[model samples]
Target: MRMAAGTEDRERGADLAEAAPIIRANGLSVYYGTKQVLSDVTLDFPSNKVTAIIGPSGCGKSTLLRCFNRMNDLIPNFNMTGQILFDGVDLYGPGVDSTEIRYQVGMVFQRPNPFPKSIFDNVAFGPKINGYEGKLDELVEQSLRRAALWEEVKDRLKSSALALSGGQQQRLCIARALAVHPRVILMDEPCSALDPFATLAIEELMRELSEDYSIIIVTHNMQQAARASDYTAFLMGNEERIGELIEFGETRQITTNPEDERTEAYITGRFG
Candidate 1:
């Protein structure tokens, strides 16, 4: 399919698992009651690649991210028009289960939101609720290890998650998402709340995780996006507060040589 004039084609890259996109948004627009948040935005998230959504505040970055997993449906008066395809299947089509979509497409929020339960229980919660019959102990350990937090809290599995540091809590949240064995992971500013060192840790973890899972992240940090992502989508909000996709392409190109003047302006710190 031919992309719009300003949109970039899916570039061949070593980080992408396949040329075909795992998630495709066709003319996607989102509204909250009478207020339109995102207008006719279309983009693709390639398999096994880190796609960063960057823009100024209120540009619908998070709203578009939430649409992938139907997380926006939780908000009252939220609605949208467009087709979000996951592996050629329309996520909003008839008979599509939002719960099942969330299972396959997990999310990690800007803040670490671990349950008040123990560390082990936080990782085990998803599988338990899904009626997983596998060895829960093994699953917990595997998830924590994948999130690169097992060694830190391995001996304290029974300890409260709230007791861990902020960075640890965020990794625990990622581990919780991984516990469900999701095919895609949606992260909304996963490192926003962390210190520089913690943020770098999360970035490193994202690079490692992208080897196995397709990742879409919404971030305000230009450096983080350039350093961690394989592809980038730039969104901008107008005076009416409706967000539009200004540019989309490989991270290096988007960062170093953007096609759109607005994208270049934003990336070069002229405006946000």
Candidate 2:
């Protein structure tokens, strides 16, 4: 028998509350020059779970994701207020190394961006630069297996990564991220460039990966967010509020019975 929606939501909330969040954002506001992109956003990301950020175009979902690993620092005139905590440490605090932070938090972009080098080289690049002392080949194989690409590309490891299909290249990118042993993986519209079949494959891989790594994805597809994530955050912004988190909760709760009317409207096709 199924529980009532309220009861289910309460139980899930309690369970999540008990787990220490792997990442936390408090009063996180970002800006590029004088334009504010995000404002006073505070949220907790549960450990070892998939969290999806859904919003309309130009809502700063990608910007928020980039902040977690300090990717926004590369952009000129990028400035942010407030704190993002990883494992209880402030990411923007003084004396922190952004390069080390990036290694611990990997990212995969929207397009399947594979290197011009061979598949083996692509996976080994991160570890090689970081001065890995262990067996390089084993690490490459393990990362590929974790990303569910080893079986398909095992026989052709020497082939150029550009030679793989779109889906395979994305998986290769995922493998490259995993090669560095990141605790969290950030995906920015990972399936927007793929066909339905390839999209499904990526979703399946996400589910499996969530058992070992915290996965945060930004997707425009509502169905993909509902199907692939354990928790969902709905963001909306206007001329006044650039990117504010409207509602955040379990996937079922947020998708089925959102407490905010704005969330209901966006999810039900009433308005963006």
Candidate 3:
């Protein structure tokens, strides 16, 4: 029997609380018109934990993040064959709605891309589309507060989103994502373009959000991953790489006494 989104999310939450993966990927592969950007890959993301995917450039980290929300569909000629299950439902099922998956699994990109519209409009865009009929003003305020952005942008809700500083704009984007209340949040190099202070602000916000949201971040910054994540997945991108899974343990172990030689080399500044 098909399950409603709410029921599915609840089931996934309970299963994860009992130590199961909320999202599981198996034999995942991707092709950009047969270039085969990503080869056979498998991984599982447990809920409510900060899981960071770290890898060198072109290592398929971002490609893998896109798979969770199916954002890869936007790229022309992109194709994939695999299973990405959320709440025990395969997102690639024949009749599944890609839009629905996006609603449940929101994403934040490397550069903050706020709408040219007002700040209030930016946060309300998603809710409006999904037919949010409740008190929207309250929702926007609550989401901003959760993103640690209300205090900074509360008085300027009517101002153009472009008017905000870079850091504030990124925070606004995060607030916008939080407003949608997705079960899982996919972040792709979210801090790559931010200043140190802005980066720190985002890290703190992610830590706080993990209490109520399952967050997966792809970061090239090893220290940032170590500092912000509860668990880390180090990936090496190459033909022989097979996206090597260096370590899938606590942030401390992966950062300190990692069992994999490659992991030690990367963390100890041997190579990226």
Candidate 3 residue pairs that clash: none
205, model 3: CA deviation in Å?
A: 0.6
Instruction: Give the clashing residue pairs of candidate 2, or none.
Output: none
Candidate 2 lDDT by residue in tens digits, 1-272: 11122233555667677768888888889999999999888888888999999888788899999999999999999999989999899999999999999999999999999889999999999999999999999999999999999999999999999999999999999999999999999999999999999999999999999999999999999999999999988888967769988888888888889888878998888887
In angstroms, the error of model 3 at 149 is 0.6
User: Each prediction's Cα lDDT score?
Assistant: 0.91, 0.91, 0.82
Deviation in Å, model 2, residue 118 alpha carbon? 0.2
TM-score of predicted model 3? 0.90
Candidate 3 residue-wise lDDT, 1-272, digit = tens? 21211223433334334656668777687888957766666666877888999877777889889989989989999898878898789988889999989888989889999999999999999999989999999999998898888998889999999998888888888889888889899999899899999999999999999988889999999989999998777777666544534445567777878767777888888887
Task: Compare candidates 1 and 3 on TM-score and give the better one.
Answer: 1
**Regions more than 4 Å wrong, model 1:** 8-18
Best of the candidates, lDDT: 1
Quick one: RMSD of model 3?
A: 6.0
**Error in Å for residue 62 of model 2:** 0.7
User: For model 1, how does the per-residue alpha-carbon lDDT over 144-261 read when each residue is reduced to its tens digit?
Assistant: 9999999999999999999999999999999999999999999999999999998999999999999999999999999999999999999999888799988887899888788899
